[model samples]
Target: MSTGSFVSAASVENHGVVCDCGLPSPVRRSWTRRNPDRRFHTCKGRRVENGYIDCGFFRWYNQGDPSGWQFLALLEAREMMEEQRMQIAALTNEVTTLSMNAENDVKSKELGNRCEALKRDVQVLTERCIGLQNVLIASTVGFGAVFGVMMLMWTSNTA
Candidate 1:
């Protein structure tokens, strides 16, 4: 008899969990939670019934490996990582919008100031024109007013 040399299916299937040969075989159990079920097979060769022509083997089908827990853990980790990535993207978008709004505000204020300066310059030029016109009208009264013209009528002045 080969001792410690035969390959146990549980080791290869369950990551070295205790083999069911230590327990019984043809196992089927249902518990709470999603109508959860478990099924597996071990190599401790149970006998079949009488009038059976096959060997001393019980074939148990529909038995999945013991990867349910590990797969769940992996799925949870992936979901957490995806949530973190979405948060980062949302934060990045928020930061970009804030920065652009700040820049636009600064530019708008600068343009408003420039427009005010141009308005002030136009007002100053208009006031200067009005003052120059007033000065010319007053000087023309001294040189060619209606009374200075009467003096020129005293012999057509320089004629």
Candidate 2:
């Protein structure tokens, strides 16, 4: 068929879909225009044969533009690139989150160790203070007894 009109395509969702003659043709992909983006396909012949259809195959354009296969390849490549970019972004975010969590864990462990060390130091200091208090009390009692004896001896000598 000679290229005349555009080959427009549309998607239809149906549980039971059939061709014009009621023949079953499983859908390929959701549906896409043959060359509606840039060029289209149409029949140049009259609509008489093939059950009032122009030609068995429609005619779009390929004179100035690229072929349909080329356009499809380009579209597929773009889709793959988009998916790859999304994957990379997700992986980067995961790595950053993991690093932050690791750093927090280390800091928490260090704080816990410091708290334990401080508790041990407090225990040691409290024990030392108790020992010093006991020694002070004993020294005071001994001094009082010695002074009492000294006073008694002085009184006796004077008498």
Candidate 3:
């Protein structure tokens, strides 16, 4: 195809440019080892997995040499930004985990303290119950002794 068939980058509408095959052009990344990061517009037919033909609608969205220092710097900066974003996400997840663990630890300590207090209360109640039982036994024995002495006096007077 002659170069005239391809529209200049500025001449094409940003939203609604179609290829000669009557399909919209999609911006795609170049996977060539030499220019992996370069972007361009092409026909969707080119991406088909079946035995389909390409429309050859080509235009460089990032028009520059992939080997140039400025382009390489831009790519490096993009890679660094992605790495930083991933690090931020990982740190956020770690912070959430640590926060949950700290909260659980505090709750466990409080539960243990409550359990100890309940045990001490139960010990005090048990001591009180034992004291009450001892008092009841002593009173019963004293009453029996007084009743026996009165019965002896009455029988002696009658005899």
**Cα RMSD to the true fold for all candidates:** 16.8, 13.6, 8.1
Query: Which ranges of candidate 1 are over 4 A from the true structure?
Result: 1-66, 150-159
- Using TM-score as the yardstick, the better of models 1 and 3 is 3
The total of clashing pairs for model 2 equals 5
Error of 1 at 105 (Å): 0.5
Winner by lDDT between candidate 2 and candidate 1? 2
lDDT of 2 by residue, 1-159 (tens): 224633334333323444444433222221133432454333323445565543343233334554567678856765687799999999999999999999999999999999999999999999999999999988888898888899899999999
Ten consecutive residues with minimal summed lDDT in candidate 2? 24-33
- Against the hidden reference, what TM-scores do the models get? 0.49, 0.52, 0.61
TM-score, cand. 1 vs. native: 0.49
RMSD of 3: 8.1
TM-score winner, 1 or 2:
2
